[model samples]
Structure formats: C-alpha cells, structure tokens
Target chain A: MKIENIKKEFPIFNNKVQNNDLVYLDSANSSQKPLVVVDRIYDFYTKEFSNVGRSVHYLAVAATNLYENTRSAVQKYINAKHKNEIVFTKGATEAINLVANTFGQKYLKEGDEILLTELEHHSNYVPWHYLRKNKGIKINFAEIDEHGDISLEDIEKQITNRTKIIAITHLSNVTGAILPIKEITELAHSKGIPVLVDGCQSAPHMKMNMQDLDCDFYAISCHKMYGPTGLGVLYAKKKWLDDLPPYQGGGGMINEVKKDDISFGELPNKFEAGTMATAQVIAFNESINFLNKIGVENLVKHENDLLNYGEELLRKNNSVKLIGNPRKKGAVLSFTIDGIHPHDIATILDEDGVAIRAGHHCCQILHDKLGLTASARASLGVYNSKDDLDKLNESINNCKKIFNK
Target chain B: MNLKELYQEIILDHGKNPRNLGKFDNFNKDAKGHNPLCGDKVHLFLKLDENKKVNDISFEGEGCAISMASASIMTDLMKGKSEKDAKEIIEKFLDMIKEKDDIDTKLLEEDEKTKLMSLGGVKNYPMRVKCATLSWHALSSALEDFQKEVTTE
Candidate 1:
C-alpha cells in the first residue's frame, strides 16, 4: 500500500469524530486496525472457528493450522532462528512477566541484580520489581542524560558483577528515544549477562530481527501493531526457551499427567497455557501480512518524515516545550505548553477532533525524572500524514487563544 | 458538547486564581485525592471547630481548568457551614454532577447555588466528569474521617 492512501485502508478514518474528520495521533497508545485485519477476525469466527489443537474434527484441524501459521509468520517476520521460538501471549505485559517469572525462578537469588533504565514502561519494571520484593533481587536503573537517550556507556556504567539480566525498552513510549539494543546486548553478553527487550514500541515502527539484535527475549504487543487486542508475541532464543521452566501449568502445555509425575510439552507450547487467543492469533497473521505489504523500510521513512514534520512544527510554537532532545528518536512527540496543563490542552484539542494522549504514557518514572507529572504526546503511524500535523498545529493555536496566552 | 459551557468565564477565573489555596497550620481532618489516569492530585485540609462547624477549608494541588475551578468553587462555598449542612451540600452537589439538572440546598444562598451549578456543564463530557468531581470526593473523605486516600479510578 502506498503511504499516501494508507488512511483509506482503516475504516475508522471514514467516520467523523465529534462532527470532524478524525485526526488520530495516538498510535503509540494503540494503532487503528485496517479492513483486512478486521475481516480476517470476522471470517475466522464465522467460517473457521474452533478451539484449536485439541479436537480431531475438520474445523478443529483447520483452526489449529491457522493458529500455528501465525507463529510461523511471526518467526519469519522477526527472523527467529527456530519456528518454535515464538510464543503467543495475552499481551506484551504477560510476555515480560513470563520471562521475569521463569528467569527469576531459574537464575536469580538474593543479592542478584537486574539492570533497567529510567525510560522503561511500568510493564517492564513492575514485573521485575516483584522479584525484588519476593526474591530479594535488586534493580538498578541506568539514568538518561539531558537528551533523554540512554547511551551504551550509560548501560556499561550501571553494569555490576551481580547484574544477572538486563531488561530494557527497545524504544521509549514517552521520549521516543531508540535505545542501542544491539550494542547493549553485546556488552551484556561480554559480561555473561542475558538481555530481555520490551519491543512494544519498536516492533510496530522498525524492522525487527531477533538474530541481528541478539537479545535473549523480545516481547511484542499485537494491538499496537494494527492487529487485534489480547494477543502478543514473545520471541525468545531457543536456548532460553529450553533452559527456563514453564510459566503456567495447564492442559495444552502438559505432555503427561501421571498421578505422581507430570511433564511439560515442547518449546512454545510449554509457555502458552490454557486456551489461547485463537481468533486474535489467527488475525495477527493478517497484521504481519499488512506490515509486509507496506514494507518496513517504507514504513520507517514515512514515519520519520512525520516525526520530523511534527517536531519542527511544535518547536516553532512558543511555550511548547518538547520533552526530549534525543538524536535517535521514533514517532513520539511529547511536549508541555508553559502555562496550560496537559489535561486542559487535551480537552481543548479534542474539540477539533485532534486526539492525543495526555499523561505519563505509562512511563511514570521517566515523567518523575523529568520533574513533570504529565505531558501531551502526539504519536504517528503509517496512516498519518503531514495534514494531520498541520491540523494539530492549528488546534494548538486555538487552545492558546482560548487561554489568552 | 459546547466548550464554552464547560469552560465559562467564572470557571476560568477561579481556575486561574483559586481561593483558599494553602495548607492550614492546624487542621482537624485531611485527605489526598488523585486521578491516576491524568496525574491530577488534590490535598484537602479542613479545620472543624468544637461545634462541628467548618472553621476553614483550603486545598493544594494541580489539575486542569475544570478540576481546579470545581475545587476552588467547592472550597469557597464549604466554609462556615456545620458538618451536617456540609454533608447535605456535598450530596446535593454530587447529585447535580451525576444526573440532576440543578441543586437546591437550604445551606447555600441563591448565588452560591448558581456558582455550584456552573460545574454542571461537565455533565456533557462523560470523561471529564471525574475531573469535576475529584476534589468533592476528597472533601467528603476528609469530612467523614475516611482513613484512606481518595482516588477516582
């Protein structure tokens, strides 16, 4: 699909929001779904619906094939070495929790440490914190510099002999700072430490290759990638999947359930418990196909243009102070108007059908570090255009006029 | 649906220059309220006298114009009223915010009722109703000596 006509692919843009054309700039919170993803979900339920992987009936067999097909597609999409390495999860939060729980069980003990950064979303940090509280593991944060970017040197400085795992974000949801995950992985591996990347933001906008980044585990949120909600992908190296224990115990993940002895199933099944999100997993294959058709390189260049256009527009506006000055950033544009609260700015902008997020964007630690309780963010996706940024500027000017600034 | 109704002149004035916006040196009851979604916070302080009458009412926090104005107007009308009367006014105000078109309270003067009704404009915006009610909930928690912090989840 061409970038210029991408907005037409999403049915939501055809409808008006509050009597105005929808200028959705909140893709970082969640991307709008295209017609193909929506139709795939409907078609699966109406025609090929089944509980997948259990029954011997024709529909069950077909549904199971459809479900496993998504795993294979995701493996190829992320360039995982083995098809069994991609595990379907409820969402990225659970994916991170799975790694934290199993890794904490097998590798960590008291006085051991997990290194993180200030830019991590709460989903990444809070799960590890459970280990800190229950198992007495410590979490050390590598602070961001004035530019809000976490450099390789910063990660190296925070690394200690006790650092067992390094869990960090591939890209910040708030500051849009793209971390040096490949180099960070190299540094951590040199010290005999494993790396888990929270790829919720990066997987949508960037080209992801598990082999190239060499991170031990990577988590993805499908809904943020224009797929259905309640479906996630966890890309773990075959080594870690083989070494770590299963996260949950249930019917599908069991190989044998003898009275006294029970054994787990194979690579991906051992981690996925209970009935999975069948329809979402099947529908996410369409999401992968959608991304593939657009081409990751084209998506990258289009979003980069939007980000630069948005940044320059907001920078020219007086009293609009942006959150970060990172040299390497993604599609997030967070800022604060000097005298206007972010909530008020959001409320005013909503009148013009300009939707943006006004909060910590689930990175409260980063907000606190920046000495702000909240900020306004305008994020981009493939469907976004320069016209949307122009409308955003006009709406901001209206907000300023209302406040008599 | 109209932005002007939601942000009238009175609300903007009060939000810009809120009255009774400081901590009390001696306070009988206090409660903190927060809207975790928007990161808005309000710390309410009350000084109740021997006869259970409000001696002073003040607040300190940061939020949007609607929230700040609601808090400012709420604090301005709550002072010098007895605890029983305060409860009645709070109920009336909350009722007006929830569904009622207007509040009729014997405790408040005609002009005070008009000031309180200005916040009713928030009824049109479902998401922002919480912004208009967070401070009032905090005030109620403070009055009843609720031991936990108030949150509009």
Candidate 2:
C-alpha cells in the first residue's frame, strides 16, 4: 500500500487542529482507528445489530454470526489450536487481571514466586501485589540491562525452584525491545511453570503464531491494532483452558442452571458469561483484516526503518539523551533533553501540533532504575512516516533554543 | 524566553536560585510527599518561629522542571505568611487549577490566593495537574504535621 493511501484510512489524520495536521505519535498508547474498522461497527449497528448468543431471531442470529466469526478470525490470526482458546476481554489490563486472579491465585501458593521483569508495565505488576494480600504469593523482579532489555541471565536468577509462573511482555512498551519469548517459554516449561506473554505492543506490529511461540498464555488489545476500544484478546493454550476454571460467571456461560447444582458450559463460552460486544468484536475482526492487507512483516520492516532513522537523528544531537538502545525493538524512542523537563518538552511539542507522551509513562520502576526523573516518548505506528519524525526533530531542536538547554 | 513572561518575576527569581534548595543543617519539622505518577518527590524542612510562622522553609526533591520550579516558588511564597494564610493559598491553588474561571468570583481577588492562582494555566493539561500541584500538596501535609505538633503541646 502507498503511504498516502494508508494515511487516508484514518479520519483523524485530516483533523485541522491548531491550523496544522495532528501528528499522532502515541500509537503505543493506542492506535488511531481506520475508517473501515469504524464503518464496520457503524454498519453492524445500522443493519444486523442485536444481542448475540441469545434469541434465535434474525438480528440475533446475524449478531451471533458476526461475534463468533470474530473468534474464528482471531483464532486464525494467532494460529490458536482451537477457537475456544480465544477469549474476548475488555483490554490487556483486564485480561492480565483475569489470569492473575483465576489462574495465578488458584494454582499458586504461599512462598511460591511470580517472576516478572523490571521492564514490565504496572498492569502486570499490581495484580501480583493483590496476591500478597490474599494468597501470600511472593513477587520477584528480574533485572533489566543498562539498555533496558531483559535477558535470560537476569530472568534465570529470579526463577527459583518454587517459582510457579513467569509473566512477561513480548515487547517493552518503554524501550520497544522484543524479548526472547520462545526461549523464555521453553525455560518456564522446563521448570513446569506456565508463562503469560503480554503481547500488547508486539501483536499490532508483528505476526503472532502462538502455536509456534508456545507460550501458555498471550494477551492483546484490539484498540492497539487500529480496532475500536473496549475489547481485547486472550490466547490461552488448549491444555490450560481444559483444566483452568472460568474467570467470570453469569448467564450464557452455563450449560444448565439448576436450583441445587449448575453445570458449566464448554471451553470459550465458560469465559464469556455476559452479553458480548457483538459489533465491536466484528470491527475487531476487521482490524485483523487491516493488518493482513498491509502484511505484518512489511509493516515491521517499514517501522524498523523509521526506528533506525529516528535513532540516527537523535544520536547526533548532544543535548538529547537516549535511554534504551536495543537493536531489536519497536519504534518507541524515549529520551530527555539536558535542561528541559518532559512536561515542558511535551507541551512545546504539542504547541507545534506534534503529540508525544511525557512523565514516567506508567513505568516508575524502570525510571527509578534509569535514574531519570521522567522522559518524553515518541512512538511510531503503521501510518507514521519520516516527515512525522522530522517534525519531532524540529520541535525538539526548538526546545533547545527556547529553554537554552 | 524571559522566565518572568511565564512565571511572576518573584517566582522566576526564586526558581532560578531557590532560597533553600540545599539540605537543612539544623532541620526540625520534616515530611515527604511522593507523586508516584511521575516519580517526583518533595522533602520539606521547616524552622517555625515562636508565633508559628514559617521562619525558614527548605525543600529537596527529584522532579520535572515544572515541579522543581513550583516547589522552589512555593517555599519562597511561605517565608512570612501565617500558617493559616499558607494553608488557604494551598487550598485556593488546587481549586484554581481544577476549576479555573468557574471559581467563586469574589475569592479570585483575595491577595494570598491570587499569588499562586496565577498558575491556573497548568490546569489545561489534566495529566500535568499533579505536576504543578505536587509541591503544594507536600507543603500542605508538612504543615499538617506542624499543626498537629502545635496542638499536641
């Protein structure tokens, strides 16, 4: 696809805010929705809209098909062994919580460890904190290298004989470094520990084949892949799904509701208890199509080029201090100017119609380890280009001039 | 850019070379406030006068320039004000940040509140509201401890 045509897909790209183009650099936070994904949702509500998995009426049947079709699409996208292995969730945050509660607490015990990396987001961190309250589970953190990449050497140190689970992010949202998940999973499996891979940053930019990766669990959000919000995907292994009990219980997830004894339904249905987001799921399927059309591999190469260019540009400027320098990572480049604060840096960039994130970026532990107060981050997406980065470079130089840094 | 253009000349002068950025040699009252969101912290030291006014105010912290500057300005603002007036300024500062022009019309003109209320522009960015208010919150809590001590006697 031509860059211009890809840019045209998003309606927000055309928004004339402050009499300039809105250069969105916060894709790591959430991707901008394309028109097709938006319209599919609009059309679903306009035509075949109804509560799914409920009534056998025309609209309900169509709604059910749309909703179930999404499961089949996600099943193929991740190459899951079965569609039942794919559970719809609110977002990666909620999906991680469900597993930490249902899978972690149920299986883990007192003095048992939940090993994680220092590079992890707080969503993965705080859930284990809850276990300390209820289950007396111990939390252990793996060290991050100076470049902010997690190594097996650090991970190995934290994993004791008593370690039951290892939860990790596939891509560091801060440094954009990709972890060796297959190797990590193999080590975890050798110890008879289940691994949960947070694929929030990886899934949108790269191809995922869970069958090959063989992680026990993988979680992603639809909105991160240019889909609508309020929906996520949790890809669990077939064996794990068969043994683990349901996370939530209500209507639709049960096979038989009796006065005394109620029977639970099959694999995926047991996870989805309430009414599902039929239209949103269908729209989410369209996001998979959106990725498929451009091809995730091609998208990866294009983004890597941007990352290389961005790194080269920042490397020359002595005033800017780059945090992480992982050769293999996503396009999120976090840096801090010598004298200017991240807040002032972000606001100055915003005034020039270039959006960037400031502050600790929900990774306080990483900041503490880096000895940084806070750093500004500019992340790339499929729609980003060299010109967008040029704007960032120009604005950053302007920060030097304005603040005399 | 002239610092006075954005901040009051008084604020700029104080922020450039803060009154007491160093460690307090003979510190008495002390408290700490941490903004976990941005990983910014403010440790305050006070030597209260016999009349309970702030005789010496010093701060130490790791924060963004806005937070550091705000704390610097705040310590300067508290030099001679009574404890009651200082607390009122802190209250009015938060009110002004969260609800700018919508504030009670009469209170905007009040001298003590208006000094820091000039910083209400930081309210536009909701994420940054905490950055601007971190120092004020620390001062509020530190004074909380001071008040507690005064009543305890």
Candidate 3:
C-alpha cells in the first residue's frame, strides 16, 4: 500500500478544519474512520439491516453470520485459539468491567490484591477499583521507572500470595511506554496469577498474538482500530469463559429462561447479553480488511517514523519538555511547554488546525506520578506523517511566542 | 474564536504571574473547585470581615492560562468588596461566559471589567468555558459556605 496516500482513504481528511488542512494527531484517543469502514456502516444500515441471531428469516440469518464473521475475523487477527473467545461489548471499558465483575465474583476474596501499573488508563484501573470497593480486595500499583516504563521486576515486586490477578496496559497512553506483555505474562503465570492486557493502545499499532503473549484476557477498543465506535472485542481464554459467570442477564445470553432456574448460553453469547451493536460489528469487518491490506508491520514502521521525527523536533525546542523517555515508546508525543499550560498549547495548536489532545489523557495516576496536573499529547495514526509533526512543531513555537517563553 | 482575542496580554500576564496567589492565613471562607474533564483545580480563600466585606481574598491552584488568569483577576477585584457584591459579580461573569455577550459594566471598574471581559473570548470555545469560570464558581461556593467541593463535570 502507498502509505503516503493513505489519508485519502479517510473522508475526514478531505475537508478543512479552521480553513487549514486538519492535522489530526489525536488518534491515541480515537482513530479517524476510513472510507471503507464508513461505507460498510452505511451499506449495512440501508440495504442489509436486521436483528441478528433472533429469527430464522433470511435477513436475520445473514445478519447473524455477518456479526459472527467479525468474531472470527478478530480471532484470526489476534490469533486467538478459538473463534468463540471473542465477545462483543459496548467498548473496551465495558470489556474490562465484564472481567472485573465476573472474575471478582468467582475468584477474588477479601484482602486479595489486583496489581496494576501506574501507567494504566482509567478503563484498566477503575473496573478493578469497583472490586476493591465492594469485595474488600486491595489494589496495588506497580510503579513506573524514571523513564515511565514498567519492567517485569516491577510487576514481580508487587505480587504476593494474596494477589488474585495482574492487569496492566499493553501501552501507556500518557507516556507511550510499551510494556513487555509476553514477559510479564510469563512471570505472572509462574506465580499462578492470571494477566489481563489492556490492548487499547497496542492493538492499533502492533502485532498481537494471543499464544505469544499468553495473557489470560485482552481488551480491545474498536474505535481506536479505525473501526466503528460503540463496539469492542474481548479476547479471553476459553477456560476462563467457561469458569466465570455471565456478566449481564438479558436476552440471547441464556440457553433457556425459566422463572426459578435458567441455563446460560455457550461461549461468547453468554457474555454478550441483550441486543448488540450489530451494524458496528458488521462494519468492523471492513476495519480488519483495512488493517490487513496495509499490514500491521507497515503501519508500525510508518507510525514509528512519525513518533521519532516528532520527538526529535519537540526535543530540539528548548521550551518543550517531554513527559517520559521510555526506551521503547509508541506513536505518542506528550509534553509540557515552559510558561504555558497544556490547555493553552492545545488552544493555540487548534488555531492552526493542529488537533491534539491535552490534559491527563485519562491516566491520572501517571500524571500524579509525573508531578503534573496535565500535559499536551500529539499521538499519531496510520494516516499521519512528518508533515503533521512539522505543523505541530510550528504550533508549539507559536504557543511559546505567545507566552513569551 | 480568535486566538489573539482569547489570549490577550492581560490574560497571559495574570496567568504567568497571578495576582493574590497563595492561601491566606486569616481566610475564613474557602472552597476548592475542580474541573474533572481537564483536571484543573482552584482553591479559593476569602477573609470576610465583621461587616461581611472581603478584607482579603487569595487563591492557589494549577490550571490553564484562562483559568489562572480568571481566578487572579477575580481575586484582585474581589478584595474589599462585600460578600453580596462578590456573589453578584461572580454571577455576572459566569453569565457572560456561558451565554451573555457582555458583562454588566456597573458590576466592576473600567479596568477590572476589561480584565474580566478579556475572558469573554472563552464563550466561543465551548469546551473551554469551564476553564474560564472554574474559579469564579469556587468563589461562589466559598461565599455560600458549601461543604462539598464544586466540580465542573
């Protein structure tokens, strides 16, 4: 694929933001949808819409197949062993909550600890906190190093006999630190602790194989994958799917509904209760196709190039101070400018049609550790290039000039 | 909508070197305000005398230029004003940022009104309206003696 012309695949890039070409560098928050994904959504809603897995009608059966096709596509993409391991949820936040609720009910007890890292987004940490509040479980944090990276030793240091499970982010959203999931999972398994990898950041930028990582559970955000919003994929080991109770009680999740007793359905359906985002699930097949066309390896190289260029440019600017210097980083450039707040930087950047995210980026614990209330982040996606970084650098200079720094 | 108007010289000056900063030792009424969306925080301290007039007002917080300047300018104008006058001014300022195009000129002096109106540019940026008004709301909560922390969700 011609990576330079990839922005043409997204309709959003065709228009101007504030009379200037949109320099969208906020993909760490949510990626812009490609033309293929958007078209799939429209096509499904207009010509081939139906409630899936409900009726034996031709449209219903076809819709059901399309929905399940996404499951198999996700299974194949992530290399999960079983197709049934992929369960759909509202988003990654709901996916993590499902595990915390079901696993907390089945496994956790009073005084049990759920070890998380300081780099986790609220989606990874807040769900476990619910268990801490209700189940009397303790939550321990694996501290980040000076470079904002969490090592295997950091996870090992927090583990105890009472540690029930270890949940960590595959990539830090704030510091862009990529965790060694395969190694961390191996160490957790040695101590009989299950590891849950929050792959919201990693899934869009790297190659993921369930067997290679060996993590018990992985949560994916579809919106960040150039897929439709209101859809997420939860990849769990089938053993846990069978052992844990259903997350929600509603239609399509139960094998037989009875007044006194009920039997839940099998595998993914048991966890996916009620009517799902049928159109989103169907459209997400296009997202997988989009990623497959370019290939994740190509995407990684392109984004890494942008990251390196943006990092070098920002580092050369004396007023700009980057948050972390992790040895292994992703496509995120988070920084603070001297004599300027992040909000001001964001406003000034937006004036030049440079769209970046400001504030803690939903990683408050990490921000607290960095001793900053907020910082500005310019994260990249497949469509971004060095030109966008140049715009960002120019905007930073404008912000510094405005503040007389 | 214009960046130049939104970030005027006065706003930047106050943001860089905020006036009436730091907690007051004799503060009697105080309240902390938080903008959970952006993580901006303001702790306002007020010392109302026996006549219910603001003898001294100060604040300490971390926020964007708009917020810090808003708080700094607010504290500068609030000193020596009656509690009733402080509440009225806060209401007017918030009204201007939220919906009203201009703040009532009678509420403040010409220089003070211009400083407060400098923040009026925030009205165009809907996402940042909270940044400009977070401290003013904190002052309102302090005057009312609200026990809970004020939040701009």
Candidate with best DockQ: 3
Ten residues in sequence with the least summed lDDT for candidate 1 chain A: A396-405
| Whole-model Cα lDDT of every candidate shown, in order | 0.92, 0.81, 0.90
Q: Estimate, for each residue in A1-405, the C-alpha lDDT of model 1 and write its tens digit.
A: 898999889999999998999999999999999999999999998988999989999999999999999999999999999999999999999999999999999999999999999999999999999999999999999999999999999999999999999999999998999999999999999999999999999999999899999999999999999999999999999999999999999979989999999999987789988999999999999999999999999999999999999999999999899989887999899999987889888888888999999988888999999999899999999999999999999999988877777
If both were scored by DockQ, which would come out higher, candidate 1 or candidate 3? Answer: 3
For model 2, how does the per-residue alpha-carbon lDDT over A124-217 read when each residue is reduced to its tens digit? 8887789977888988899988788987777888989989899998998888889999988988899899999999989988888998999999
lDDT of 3 at A65: 96
Q: How accurate is chain B of model 1, given as a TM-score from 0 to 1?
A: 0.94
Candidate 3, residues B1-153: lDDT per residue as tens digits?
Answer: 376656857555775678999986988999999998677899999999999999999999987888888888899999889988888898888888888877884868888887777788778787699988899889999999998999877
lDDT per residue (tens digit) for residues A1-405 in model 3:
689999999999999987989999999999999999999989998988999999999999999999999999999999999999999999999999999999999999999999999999999999999998998999999999999999889889989999989999998998899999999999899889999999999999999899889999999999999999999989999999999999999999999877899999988889988999999999999999999999889998998888988889998999799988887999888999876888888998998999999988889888999988889999999999888899899988887788878
Chain B TM-score list for all models: 0.94, 0.74, 0.94
Q: Which 10 consecutive residues of model 2 chain A have the lowest summed lDDT?
A: A396-405
The CAPRI class of candidate 1 is medium
Candidate 2: docking tier:
acceptable
- Candidate 2 — number of clashing residue pairs? 0
